[model samples]
Target: MQTYARRLALVLAFTLLPLSGCKRTHQIIHHATSSEPDYTPQILADITPGHIDGMKYPDFTDIQAQVNNLYDMRDVDALWVKGGKPTAQADAMLQEFSNAMQRGLRPEDYDASRWDERVANLKSPEGAALFDVALTVNAIRYLNDLHEGRTNPAHFTFGVKGYNEKKIDAVTILNTQIIDASDVTAAVDAAEPQSLQYKALKKGLKQYLDLVPQDHSDPLPEMNPNAKSIAITAGYPALQSLQQKLTLLGDYSGDANATASSADLTEALKHFQHRHGLNEDGKLGSATIDALNTPLTARVTQIVDTMERWRWLNDDYQNAAIIVNLPEFELRAFEGTGNDHHEVFRMNVVDGKSDDDTHHTPVIADQMKYLVFRPYWNVPPSIARKEIIPHMQKQPGYLGAKNYETVDLKGNVVSPNIAAIDKGTQMVRQKAGTSNSLGLVKFMFPNPFNVYLHDTNEKALFTRTRRDYSHGCVRLQDPPKMANWLLRDNSKWDEDSIADAMNDGQDNKTVLLPKPIPVVVFYGTAWSDDGEMHFFRDMYGYDDDLEKTLNGGRPYPQKPMKAVTEKDA
Candidate 1:
């Protein structure tokens, strides 16, 4: 332990120690990489710790350690600061913190007395703790700003000398070009193989890093030596096409046309597409190309945004969590510590309808409970009034024909004669069946929106590249498969037993949750891991909106009002 501590001290000393020669070398690397005509001066002026090129000055071991310390404290601080009132030290710390972040200066360079004042403001134990948490949160953000390309390595400037600020201006022009334009997707389609302007833009976008790195650290168990051939398939060709598109995006030099007969090559591609939210179709397609075309800078922005959201969540988020990618229309359940022991439990989903104003689901949630097999769809009153009633009105005995019954709030079954009931006031209840709105299984969780994962009667929708056919709730393409996974850990319920339940063709078998799991439904336009950036279509136009917000077009609360009120209200 003492040796480890000494090594840490050495690393810190390396980062803190000032040297004339190293700064000159950094200046040289900065000039060498300075392709921009405008950024030459700014780079020289802000030469500090944050902007040091990782490729050139590789030993960030000390700075990395300091950043981690700052993060730890900042997390604690974020919890305790309340009511927006800062104690003197807190105020000073916050100001110095923000200034240091903005200037890209190191935290240690800031006045410690400012922190002292904020600490002085804490009269109560609770207040002190709160102040500490806020301080820690600020420090964490400072670290993030350094790591993400948002702030300079040593200075807190929003972009590198020339790239970041100007790139957004250019992207703004592109966004404008799309506005009032009919068929924006078609415009993107026509520009495929990328226009020269877009090529430059793509390069600029990749200049930033975002998102947690993919868990490639875990070495997969050795496969059978004799297993030379494994059948490869992607649920959607769009994803396969996306890989080729990314190859173009990355401009991978080796071979574009090389066919992979090697089992490892095929397996790797599947893993790649799967990680990128592709259908694992193994076959490349246009949708995948679109995903590949997304730039890294934008993905970095996503990471910045998601990290901010992380601050809003409770510390419990640090534990095991399930993240559902809404655009990919997929659910992934993971169990583990931070970047450790994380394994996927299941993946399958259909998305929200593209045109439905009310059905778009955000990808943020807390707890997920029981798995309902052969679940019944209690027809929402709105759907009953809007869709079912219309059908009943047009065709006499329609409710009876569809095996639907009428029920009161008391749960008393009242079989209403479709011909006799008042068309304007009466509502019908649909019984559970193979033809029921919710198919054989539904994963239930308490949430503001009554959305949940359920089996779908329209199984064919999952095959579409744009799988947004559902009203709002996620419709699993393979509910039986998901059911098997949910039951895998249960001693009484095995895969075969779950399959038997689904195959039994029964209705409404509600199974209580053995251990409730957490599910987070989140939407991100950009995501990153390692160095690769994956982009998804901004289904809700969130990326564009966020970009607008960042550019000072509108406040966040006002921007997503529709999504908020529709989901919560």
Candidate 2:
């Protein structure tokens, strides 16, 4: 009995040992799979201390890349002292990374020669990679600062441990990819996704990806009446391609392959024209072809550049704000209630000079507080000197005709008869009226430019393909709607009240908002909301400057001007 009992105990020990070994092996595997960083890498997410469930977090591979991508802008001393608060740097890096990822990657975009020299001379791939990493990080940091309304002093340095902190040149990496259309076309033909051309085009197009309203209208032009449609179709190699591009641009809403007869083609062309806000005639004119010949890659670049500017904004999703998209000639009131999707209010808008020289309106804030219906025009010095002054010199009665009040340095409105007295010094203002420079109503938000929204006598500007007719101030397509919306809840000023105020026709007719709504007058050549891309022309030539900044060009001496704080005004 004792021998049998001893055998049983030996068997049990062996079995127990294997089970213990299996348990240890399982523990090792679990640990290997379970470790996850407690923080997000690219965009800063407020992190709290707790065991971060691996499944709940972003993919580790993506997270690793994202962490590598974070742009730390602070001096090492400040960074270390701040416990590596990655907010500034992270914002910058995310802008660049998002821009790059969407825009497309190109081999030529990187300075392969410089990168190779570093790798060979340094004899350290790790070191070379580190420098590359540092460049990207710093670039991103600068972008974040701009986005957060810290526009000036574009660059920052990080103090490293022990050694004199290394200065990572942020500008060097910023303007790396202002790609031309030809390169992108070649890349597309070659199916080279990794080319710089591809990156530029891709990033550019990503801007327009958004969910548009079902009522989103397209105005297409007519086919040429002078030329035979069939013959022209045969001659144009990119006819189908152009059609596809137009469809992407919101030209044709019907079937992509639906054949159009000559008349149908003309109608289709007219449709395209209408969508583009061009003449509705069904003929391919110079203007129409020029628009058609515009490269997809260029459009993409504009879009991406515009989105980059958006990255520089205060991204408080909870804020109730008005966003004016200049190219689209539209304004939107976006209200975020800490929910999944934001509530939007959209209206048609009249933008600045459509001429290539004067189209761009600078991206700005949404601190609208009041409205001044039938406001008097305090003519700007530039306009007065350029437009009114020259004309006034030619005709002395021009001030009277234009209802302008010439003011002396003493701030009193001088009579038109005394224009000869003020003479060359030139101080003039247009009086408030229907025919006055400021139409029926003027919405006032105090700004440095003295620019604001108002009704326009030149309503024709709103109907054109390009609506940049104003000196600087925006002209609303629907002024009455704006008035009603602004004064809806206020008992003192309902829509009727606003109408009465308009009839009153008094300057400085200040009507306060029950709750002041924020308005963002932004210019984005490309913007994406809900995944469809919207494209616009780059009127300001700002994108080139931005492109240069991104590609290691000298830092923009005039970095984004620092944002005005509440204390500032």
Candidate 3:
């Protein structure tokens, strides 16, 4: 009877053992897949504490801190895996990586080519964890590049200032921006700049990239520099090629039967010239021919470079600001917010000449605090020593005839002395008048370069396509309009009152603004507006410098100015 009881006890213990095992297995599964708050132990157990340290990936070393912190927050769980397979979010992010070139980035720079292999390596749990970390690292890098730019602005010698780098935490981006989002693509797209100008440039970049493959194989014939032009005439060999090129650029809408220098061809050439920052004369001059021969691939590169520059611009300009694009010779004042924000005013501007790089405008961002009506042109020391002093010596009474006055170092009125001027102890100033270099009104932003926006005595310069005539200051075509817009907030200032202040014969009258307006003097060679891409001349060779820098060449340091020789003086 005792032996029979022992057998029954053994059977009961064995039966209950399987039931207990099943209960523990169910709990583990629940913990792994649960939506509860305290379900991290199983996930945490999957990642060993020293696994990240043991990894041999060098590409991810730069982002090691972010990756380490991200894993620690989740107790070292695999972020891109669930149920032993890659999650849908991981796949979506990989796809976005594959399309990085759409944002002016090289996909290979982000290891996009290795994505398929990385995804396939997810079969093993260890492989899954490492792949997850890599995806997170690359995603963070991609977002950063899209937000700020691949190259730092300081790499170029543009005197760029006020660039605020966007700081983002990898874990936060994963949890908030990606994890619960229904549309992963849209979530990722939010990383790019929000400016409408950037979007337009991005669209333009895509279009130009598509055109690169269709570039013409025919080499365009060179033009004779002394020849007047190649115009409407029969039997011109280059005409058909020109027509074909214009057609490829969408500038020529005429059919294949259209001949060169025909009315249709002339109009198309004019359009092309307009787009390329040339005079639209419809004649094939050397400049026009050279521009026409610029390969589509080169234009694609220009579009890419422009897009890169757009990334460096400030994301916010304090709700209202003025932007002067030096290459385009235009100033735009923008206001409002988001979709409502746009250019309230746009006008032609004359920027500094790039003559031997002496008068090239310095790119900077600052605030305009006041307007000086009938302001004096305080001659720069270099200009005074080099240009004015010699002229005064050669032509007696030249300063008085030009409305210029002599000023001691203390700014007190003094008699013009040739020896004092030659010694550089005294300065010169042009009194406010119609002939004053600063014209009627001057806008002051107070930069180190001593550059400002003002009316020009030489208004005819604005009519030229390339107006780089100033000595580092911007010349406004319509100073009255700018003053009226700037002082609109002050009830005392209206259009009529502003005009009176400008023309009231009150010399050097200064009026402080109610609020300071931000001013950004920038250089961009290409931009898009109204669904059309516009290209401009790299007036200062800045584009060439930037291109070399972007292509891994060292940026050339600016040369120091040569001392003025006796002859020059």
Model 1 lDDT per residue over 1-569, tens place: 75565556455545644753554444333433333122223322222233222121222342443433432322212222334344333454355454442222234423333455555655554445434433433333333333232312112101111222211221221233332234433333332222121223233343542111321122122334344323434433233343354344453333556643334345555555655666675533444333444444445555444433322233333233556667767666665654453556645577666576666665444566788776656666666666776887789888778878886556567766543234433446567767877776788876645777788778777776567677777877777766766666778787777876765856677787677766656564444433455555667654454455445411122222333312210
Cα TM-score per model: 0.52, 0.59, 0.81
Q: Kindly report which residue stretches of model 3 are placed more than 4 angstroms away from their true locations once superposed.
A: 1-63, 81-86, 123-130, 159-161, 165-171, 256-261, 318-320, 392-398, 415-425, 553-569
Name the candidate that leads on TM-score: 3
* Per-structure clash totals for the candidates: 42, 65, 0
Clashes of 3: 0
Better of 2 and 3 by TM-score: 3
Maximum-lDDT candidate: 3
Segments in model 1 whose C-alpha atoms lie over 4 Å from true places: 1-248, 255-303, 306-311, 318-321, 417-427, 529-531, 548-569
> How accurate locally is residue 205 in candidate 3, as Cα lDDT from 0 to 100?
83
Q: Please give, for residues 202-284, the per-residue lDDT of candidate 3 as tens digits.
A: 89888888887887647667878788877744566767787888887889986766554578888898898888888888888
